[model samples]
Every structure is written in structure tokens, then in C-alpha cells.
Target: MGGLLLNCDIGESYGAWTMGLDAEVMPYIDCANIACGFHAGDPSVMRKTVALAVAHDVTIGAHPAYPDLVGFGRRSMVCSAQEIQDLLHYQIGALDGVCRAQGAKVSYVKPHGALYNDMMANPAQLRAVVEAIARYNPQMPLMLLAMRDNAAAQAIADEFGVTLWFEAFADRAYDALGRLVSRNLPGAVHHDPETIISQALTLSRGEALIASDGSELLLAAQTLCVHGDNASSIAAVQRIRQALGKTSAS
Candidate 1:
């Protein structure tokens, strides 16, 4: 196993409101998934975020969610394949415009919130997303959750000629099947820095962490996600980066 890329969801703030500490968190992440207005970002925020990411020499990715601003794109929307494809194109195009304006390029696409979860289990939704990405830029990679035993999503990505990066969460707990434990459940999130650091180490070492059911679920991931909403997340990322650096040096 080699060092894994660390990514974070950012630029989530809306007008007259603040969200994640983007500046503080940027130095620790390899990739920055900037929200494309659908979930929680506005035009001004998106531009500023892209510039900041460029300044920090981080890879920029598009984080597109459903067109549900009020629900923060966390509520499932009933959408047909065509509808999903259209939404994906619209959102990716929005981010591409911002990235172009900022003298940067959107290197990948990561569906945000509910749309992301829906695509995990629904082949139709996955195809829609893959098709949208292929239509926009066939070379761009698709970011997806790390699955324990299933290869459906990966298969879809392969069929579409799109590279896939399996993403593991730093703050979220996992079930035995390697799926994220429902947020509605207790102990779904780990906010403690030490705990997060330990989990990250396990992931980086290609070891399986104990899931909620006490079963070991292996995940070979290329990227790890640190939530921007957590206050201590920056510190946690720093700790994980330092740990990985030391391991690599040794």
C-alpha cells in the first residue's frame, strides 16, 4: 500500500452564513471538492474557493448535488435517468465554468449528499451519473464510496471508460458490509482527533477497521474524505498526513 490521497468537501457556505474552515483545511488535503451551488455554495464563494485551492496547489474536483438547496441536497429526489443526466450536466457545467474562470480545471466529479448515496445502490442512477460524466469529459475520474464486497459501481465505471476512486470517510462509522452507518444511528460519527487518526492509519495501511457489527470489512481505497463541517477536522487531517508521511519515510 502506498500513501492515499486525502480529499475534503468545501465551499459549502451560503450568503450571510459560514460553513467549513476552507483555508485552514486546504493545506492538509490533496483534493478539494468545491460545491457547485446546488447544495450550499454561491457563485462568489465558488470562485473564491477555486482560487484558494489553486493557491494551495490542491487538486480541484466538482461536488455536484441535487437541486435541493433547502434540504442541503440530502433528501432523495425522484428522478428518471434522463432527468439525472440533465442535472449532472448542469451541475458539472456550472463548476467547470467556475474552474475555467479561476484558471484551474475540474479534475474529477463527486456527487454530493443524497445523490451520492442513491448512486451507490441504484444501477440506473449510477449509469446516469457515469453517462453524464462521460458526456462532459470522458477522461475525468468519478469518486465513489468504498464498497466492501460489491463491484457494481466499479463495473459501471469500467463500462463507461471512466476511472473510479473509492473514497473512505474519516468521520463516519461503517457497518459490517463496509457501507456508511446511517447518520440517524448513534455513534455514526467520530469527532475525536485520536480516534480519527487511528482509523485513518488503519485505512492507509490497507487494514480493515472493525465495523459496527464487529466484523472486519476491507476497503482498498485511493482516497480518504475528511468532512469540512467538523471543527477539529483540520487538526485531524494534519495528524493523519503526518502519520502517513512518517510511515512512508520509514
Candidate 2:
């Protein structure tokens, strides 16, 4: 086990499509992975999110995604590794520039949606993202989904001299292989408050969970992510934070 951090995917709102409870969820998280304009944010939205994170004294992170504004970056795309690296660099720079304006810099980078999934399952894409992170700022940590097979991923990150931050879903279900269950699946997300808190506590204690396939899933993580897009997501984060606080005190 390692130090625990609560993080959230935030600043997803676009021009007129408000997507998340950014203001309500900012205070409960340790880090904010703000959208970098390609997937879900605009210039004004990015600025607002940066200001909100600064106001809450939260660590700022870049949430870069594939250029799929229509599918909300959830749909996978086919591109070369060089292209992946370039787009990632572009998105990260966008957020980094925004944070610098507010005297808060990007401390880490987390690829959003399809890009994130692609990196987890595809070696070429993973290398591309890690390479981009290393080239842009070696000190900036790259966030990846926590899994039983992170040793291999860690090795690739180490090759680039990029720090790997394993992250887990606080309210989402996992498959037998420790990957997140597809969103289309039933019971893919746990909405019950107590269940979410219990899962968080179990992870803090270095325990594994039974996956959807009735197999053990190791979700070792340094950070737990709570999605803020859905309703009541803010309350869920609040409760989980309180539970984590008590664990820290004890």
C-alpha cells in the first residue's frame, strides 16, 4: 500500500453543456484532472476550473483526451504513436499554460476516456503517452488505471523516467482482470454511499475485491478517482472523504 489520494475528473462542461458539479466536488478532492478543451472543456471553462481548483487549494492535473468531442472522448480512434504523443503534448500544454496563469502548475497528467483505456491495453499507445509525458515534463507524474499487471506498465514508465501514479475508481466495478467494467454493463458503477466508502477503506487497507466475474481483483492504487459527471456524485465524494479522513486520523 501507498499514500492515498482522492482525485476527480472535473471541468467537463463545454460551451453550453454543463457536465459536472465542479464547484461542489472541488473541495473534497486532493487533485483535479481538468479537461484540456479537446474532450469536454472550452477556454472559459478551463479558466474557471483552474480558478476553482486554486480556490480549493487542490493539486491541478492535466486531463488530456483524444479529439472526440462528439463521443465525449469515449470512442476509440486509430492513430500512429507519433500522433498520440503529439495530441497528448498539445492537450497537456493547454492545461499547463492555464495553470501557470493562476500560479498553479500542472502536477500530473491523466489521459481521458478512450485514450486512457487504449494506453492500458495497448503497448504502443502506452509508450506514446509515457514518452509524451517524459518529453513535456519528466517530473510530471502520469496517471494510469490500477491493475494487477502494473509492474509491466511501471517498467515502461520507468524506461521513460516518468513516475506512474496508479488510480482506482471509487465507485466503479472492476472485471476479473482488474480492469474497469465496461460502462454498458449492468452494475458497472456502484451508487450506494456505504458501498463506495467500504470499497475505499478496503483499498486503503491493501485488500482486493471480488470482480464481476467472481474472481479476485487487485486494485492497488495511490489515488482513488470519483467521477463528478453523474448526479449525487458530489455527495458520494464527500462521504468517501470523511471516511478516509477518519482512517488517516486512526
Candidate 3:
């Protein structure tokens, strides 16, 4: 099997308001990063999402985020390492509880939104996340962004005896350092379906991407993240999955 697994951020619907085409994209994804009620999703949404993932046989991952329901967990907040760990445990446990009800467990963890970006940029924050997962369940892997040089992150994960699944974004732009460009920046996100699919294929093939700074950047990623927030994005994900199937077979 190919080393690359397809994952998507899903189960983000909050209360009566809904988000994402979770049902439409579940079949194509290998991992479902379900929102764990902190950023988005409530008990009902979490239960429904976990059931859907179980039905589709997709690996369930806890999508932990800062407690920012109003901000959708996209706004960064000042938090200490202990606080970060607390947040992770709270969110993961909530999702795991929902998953257990459906006879499934949270197989992994992928921090959501600002917390994810914060961990990538701050080693202390990353360590807190890793430590949280390790303390909860050492077997569960922690998914973080794939960088140009992943040695530091790997070292930290190794220290905690936690497995790391370096993830790449096919629909997002990267900087020279292999960090994702800010959404506020121009051309930070790839909008075209063809561009998104091509990027997915490139990363799957272990090829280099042209960074936003016009530099060659390569990311060693074990999973590729695709967004399912809209119809056009879902269409791109479908094409991406089909294209990746050929790459995997080859």
C-alpha cells in the first residue's frame, strides 16, 4: 500500500448550523478528523459523525482545538503548556466517548485550527500535544504538519514514545520553510480543482513543491489533508482520490 493516507477535517457542524459535506467525502478519505466539541460540533453532531465514520470504515481521529466556539478555533490564544495539554485531553476524551458509543475508538489525534498551527511553530506547544497523547494512549499517533525538515518534531515524538504522522495540505500554499502560508496572504489557498489534484499527486510521489517564496520545498508526509467544506472542494477531493489510486497502484 502507498504510504500516503488521505484525511479530511470534518464533523464541524455546530448545533442547528451545519458545515462540510461529511457524508459525501467520508468514503474517499482514509481518516476522519472529527471536531471534538471545542471548536465545532456538539454531542449530537459528534455521535452522528462517529457513526458515519464507523459505517465508512474510516479511521477516527480526534480533532482537538482551543475553546473558541465563537472564533471557530481559528484564532490563536495565549495558553501555557499545561493548559494546552488540558485542552487536548478534554477534547480527545469527548470524542473518544462518542466513538465508544458507536463501538469505535479514537485511533489518532490531529489538532484543529490555531492550535495546530501553534504547535507547528512552537516546539514547547508541540511537546505538550505529544505528551497529552502519550499520557492518554501511547498507541495513538499524533498527526502534525509535514515540514521541510522534520527532525526536531521527530526527536520530540521519539522522546515521548509517540508515533508521528506528518501531514501535508494539497489545497494550501506553503512557505519556503514548508510551513503553510497564512490565509490572509494572497494565493495562500489553491482554489482550482486541477491545482489541488496536481499538488496531491506531487506530494504522494514524494516530489518537490514550489514554495510561495519561489523555492523548491519537499515535505515527507505520511498523510495528505483535503478539505470538504464546499461542493467545489469535494469535487477536487474526488478527483484527488481517483488520481492518487493510480499513483498507489504504480
Candidate 4:
């Protein structure tokens, strides 16, 4: 709470399939954007992740996605606003139930994968998401990508009386428009620890980033999104935590 909060997508293990070093990374992250059933997590996984988060005092956030288990919710699907709203309600409710059993509750909402991209690129999808959050719990903040110009998204959230938490990636390259560079493209993700930590520090200081198109992009973000899927990613998160701590303390 003292500085830019760190969040990670976690609890993505399915039956007989495991993903992410949840326990190893939970201690370093401030928020957990746990996967709901539609994406990767099952009931058991959700409950376990919620308990772990509660134990670590990390905030739980519902990571809802399009009903695409095969694609890990990264494939876009055709869905109306109403359908999207329904999906949001169903996923959030399921995760909230799991959290309740563990004496914890989801503190925020963050769409996953393709849904996240669609919402940022489509105003209609964004409005539907905002509306869903407002109706579900106006107090709950919706976490979305922070861009060079957040005014449009902010206006939509303002209309619904919903709080928005602009998020930035510390390890991903951004396009000139401030959207993340496509993962399919080369150099979309930063692999070097120095580059990742440097980007984190720059964002924490509200400094400009060199976009893929060589433009200076400033993202006004309230939180930083980090990954912890494997040993290397976990190590990066640790380095980010340490680097940010030094920056905050100074």
C-alpha cells in the first residue's frame, strides 16, 4: 500500500495439471488475480489459492475470462454485452463463494487474457465490464491496462461510479498506442532481469517508456503486473520487489 502494488495471475492449475509457483510467489505479490473456472482453476484450486492469499494477507482479485478452457482464455470469442455481464457475474460469484469458505473475499476484479485485451480495445466491452462491476459491487475496483491516455477508460468508469486501477506490465513491451506488443512478435517480452527491473523503476517513478515504435509513452498506473509461472519468473518478481523496496525507501 505504500507504493505501486504488485499483482500476479495465479491459481491456474486444472485437474491433474499444475501451473504457476503460487506459494513461492504469493509472499512477494500484493494482489492475486486468481483464475476462475472458465480459464484454468477448479473449485479445489480456487479454495486453496484463496486460503493461501488470506494467510499471506494478499488481496484476492477475481480473474474472470471468456469460457475458453482450451485456449486458456486467450482466444477471443463472440459475446454480446449481456453475455459478458452474465459471465462476469457467474465467475465472480463462484470465486467469492470459494473465498467465503476460507473467510476471505475478492477485493477487486480483473479480466483475463483475451477478454482483457478486448475490453481495452473495445469501448462497448469496456462499458459492459464496468457495468458488471458496478452492479456486482460498485466499491470493487476494476483493474485494466494503463495507457498513455486513460481519460476514455476513466470516463466510462466514472459513468458507472466504479473505481479503476490502471495496471502496467514490468516485463512486456508496449506499442506506440501503449498497448502491449503482440506476444507472437519478437522481443514482445523482456527477458533480461536488468531490463525488467529498470522498467519497473521507471514506471514507479512515473517516467516515460520507449514504446515499440520508439515513442515515449507514459503510463499512469496504480499497480504493476508481474508473473511467477516458473523459477526464472519467480526470480524476476523477487528482484522487482527488492528494487521497488529500495526505490520506495529512498
Candidate 5:
């Protein structure tokens, strides 16, 4: 339980349009997945978020996507493997530069939205992502979803010599196969604090979690994610830390 790193997506604000309670949520999380300009952040926002993460002593991670700013990087793009690698390298470097300027470095990489989903499902795209990360910096860990069946990508990650950090979501539902339930599905995103906290506890202890169709999956987690952009979810983050602290003590 103590080993699980609590992570949240932040720095989503682009230009004057702000997104996420970055400052309010920073204190509670161990890692900050900062948007790297492709999705929701600008250069200035990235700088500010990097400073915030540094101030809070949180791990900084680059959250890169398919350069879909209008769709907030949730829309998939058709691109070659080489193109994907280039965009990823560019995003990671942009964030890493900001981190370096602020005396904090990007410690990891995590694909955002559609790119994340695609990579998780397609071996070719997943290989491209792994290659990008390893080429950018092999020392930086790659954060990935920990599902019931994850061996294929794990093997690929090993082949590329990239470390994988498996994460389970605290407020999202998973399918019977241990994949995250689609956002389009009813009740895919949970809002109940108790339910979210319970799952967080289950995952931290490496226990079985009930899937959307009432199946069970045992997901191992080195880190856990909670969307901290909303006020309610931010509050859940505080409670989760408190609950995990209690469990650690017990």
C-alpha cells in the first residue's frame, strides 16, 4: 500500500481557458501527468504545472497524445508508426525541458486518451510508443494500465528495455476482460467516494475487483489514478490518501 504512487492528470489548461484544479490537487498526489501542449496545455501552462509539481515534491510525467487539440486529444488520428514516435518524442522533450528549467525532470511517460487506448489494444502502436519512450530516455518509466492480461505489452516493454508502471483507476469501471469500460457506456465513470475509495483499497492490496458485468479481476498496481480536475474527484483524492494512510498504519 505504501508503495503505490497516487497520480493525477493536471496542467490541462490551454491559454486562458483553465482546466483542472492543479494547485488544489497537487498536494494530495505523488505524480502529476502534465499535458504536453498536444491535448490541453500550452508552454506557459506546462511551465507553471512543472513548478507546482516541483514545489509539491511530486513526480512529473509527460502526458502525450496524437496532437488533437480540438478534440482534447481524445480523438484518434491515423498516422504512421514513425510519425507517432516523432510526436511523442516532441511532447516528452517539451515537458522535460520545462521540468529541467524548474529543477525537476520528467520521471515517466503516459499516453493520453485515444493514443493510450489504441496503444493498449494494438501491438504495433504499442511497440511504437515503447520505442519512442526508450529512445527519448530509457531511464524514465512508462505508465500503463494493469489488466488481467498484460503479458504481451510487458514482453514488448522488456524487449525495448523500458520499465512499465502499472496503474489502476480509482473512479473508473473496468470490463470483464479487465479493460477499462468505455466512456460512452452508462455508469462507466463512478462518482461515489465510498465506491472509489473501496476500489482504491482493493487495488492497493492487490485483491480482486468486480468488473462492470460483475466479473472479477485481480489487478496489480504500482500506482493508482484519480481524475482530479473536478471538485468532487479532488476531494476523493484527499480521502483516498487518508484511507491509504490508515491502511498502511493498520
Candidate 6:
């Protein structure tokens, strides 16, 4: 009953290539951010993932990314605000269609990879993304990385009249500013299940996290993200769920 929503990026496998043990991870998560076609998943994958989520009774969310399948949507590209907005709408609509066919509804929209990072700091891009979500389904909430005491994103969401879910990364390192450490750097990821569990517990308890510089930073989040691509990520999520259960009961 505590206010913590566990979410995972899923449906990333493309064609014959596969990524993430999504089937193993789904049961442990409350929300599944299924990849739209732009990022990594195809139509077939989307349909299957939607069905899996429906069967598991997990909340579904659209995982839209820049049209860079070659980069796995991790690489940023030069795109006009209009182009970005259009692509986002298209991606969300596609997922919505699939979810409807499966008798499931997308409950939220979360930008993926480079688009996610870029929109967090860029007002123009953020506006574009917000606008896109508003156009498609204003009631559908947006899930984005939490910014410490920053009201810009919140204000935009308010203007759009859409709920926002501030998200925190449980398996990633953070800087003193409470921003995620660049993936380009070493030690950006927590591969140890113990460390991941501890971090998730700390965040769940509304405690501060120690940044790389040994400074305490506060993160206010409604949802915690566990990357599906990491090896041993399923075990990490299971540990987190167990820890949350223990904390809740204590």
C-alpha cells in the first residue's frame, strides 16, 4: 500500500535477436513499459508483449523512443520539435491500438533512451513530448526521471492537465545533483543485487541517496525503474520486491 510503483522497460527484443528476460521480470513489476516500434520492438513483439502484460494483469505503458532502431534508441538525433511530436504520437497510437485489440489500455507514456534524457532537461523538447501526450490522451500520465525540487516539468504537466509520475532509477548511480550518472562513465550501473536492493529500499523509505561525491541527494519519485537489459536484473527486481515486502510489513 506504500506509494511505490515498480516499472520495467520490456519488449526490447527485435526480430531473432532477444533482450531482457521480460517473461521472468514481468511478475515482479507493477508496470510494463512496452517498447513501441520506433525503439526496439516490432508489431509482432508488441502484440505478444501486450498479451503477456494483460495475462499478468500488469499495468501497460507506451515506451516511445526516437526513430533510431540501429542505436536501440539510445543515440540522440537532430529532430525538429514538430518531427519529435509527430513521431511520439505515432508510436503511442500504435501501442494504443495493440493494447485495445488485446482489451488492455495503456495507462501511461514514458519516453525511452535518448529521447528520455533529452526531454528531461530541454524545455522545448519537453514541451514537444508533453504536447504529444496531451494530443493523444491527456489523461494518460507521463513517467519521467525525477528532478529535485524542479517545477518546470511539473508546471508543463499541469498546463497539459496530465498526471506525471516522477521516476527514479534503482540500479543506476547518481551524481551530487541527483541526476543520473552518465552511462558513458564507469560504475554507472549497480550490477550487484544487494546494492540494487539496498538502493531501492532507501528510495522506497523516502531516504536520501549518497551520490558519487559522497553528498546526500533527495529524489522524490512515485515510480522506480529497473532496466530490463541488465544481466541478473530479474534477480535484482525479485530482491527489491522482497525487500519492499519486508519493509512494508515491519
Better of 4 and 5 by TM-score: 4
Candidate 3 overall lDDT versus native: 0.91
lDDT of 1 by residue, 1-250 (tens): 2369888999999998889999888877888999999988999999999998999888989999999999999999999999998888887788889889878899999999999999987889999999999989989999999979658887888898998888898778999878898888999988788999999989988998899989888898989998656567776787888888832110
Better of 2 and 3 by lDDT: 3
- What local lDDT score does residue 146 receive in model 5, on the 0 to 100 scale? 92
lDDT of 5 by residue, 1-250 (tens): 2488898889999998999899888988898999999988999999999988888788889999988889999888998999999999999999989988878899999899999999998899999999999998898889999989889989999999999999999889999878899999998988898899999999888899998888888898899998777888888888888878823110
Q: Return the clash pairs for model 3, or none.
A: none
Per-prediction TM-score to the true structure, in the order listed: 0.95, 0.95, 0.97, 0.97, 0.96, 0.95
The lDDT of each candidate is 0.87, 0.87, 0.91, 0.93, 0.89, 0.87
lDDT per residue as tens, model 4, 28-100? 8899999999989999999999988998889999999999999999999999999999999999999999998
Model 1, C-alpha of 36: deviation from truth (Å) = 0.4
lDDT per residue (tens digit) for residues 102-166 in model 6: 88889999999999999986889998899888888898899998866658889988988888899
Worst 10-residue lDDT window, candidate 5? 241-250
Q: Lowest summed lDDT over 10 consecutive residues: which window, candidate 1?
A: 241-250
Runs off by more than 4 Å, candidate 4: 246-250
Say which prediction, candidate 3 or candidate 5, comes out ahead on lDDT: 3
Query: Comparing 4 and 5 by lDDT, which wins?
Result: 4
RMSD of each: 2.5, 2.4, 2.2, 2.2, 2.4, 2.5
Candidate 1 overall Cα lDDT vs. reference? Answer: 0.87
lDDT winner = 4
Give the poorly placed runs of model 1, Cα more than 4 Å off: 246-250
Q: Could you tell me how far off, in angstroms, the CA of residue 151 lies in candidate 1 after the best superposition?
A: 1.8
Q: Candidate 3 at residue 145, lDDT?
A: 93
lDDT tens string, model 2, 55-127? 8788889999999999999999998999998998899888888888989899999999999998999988899
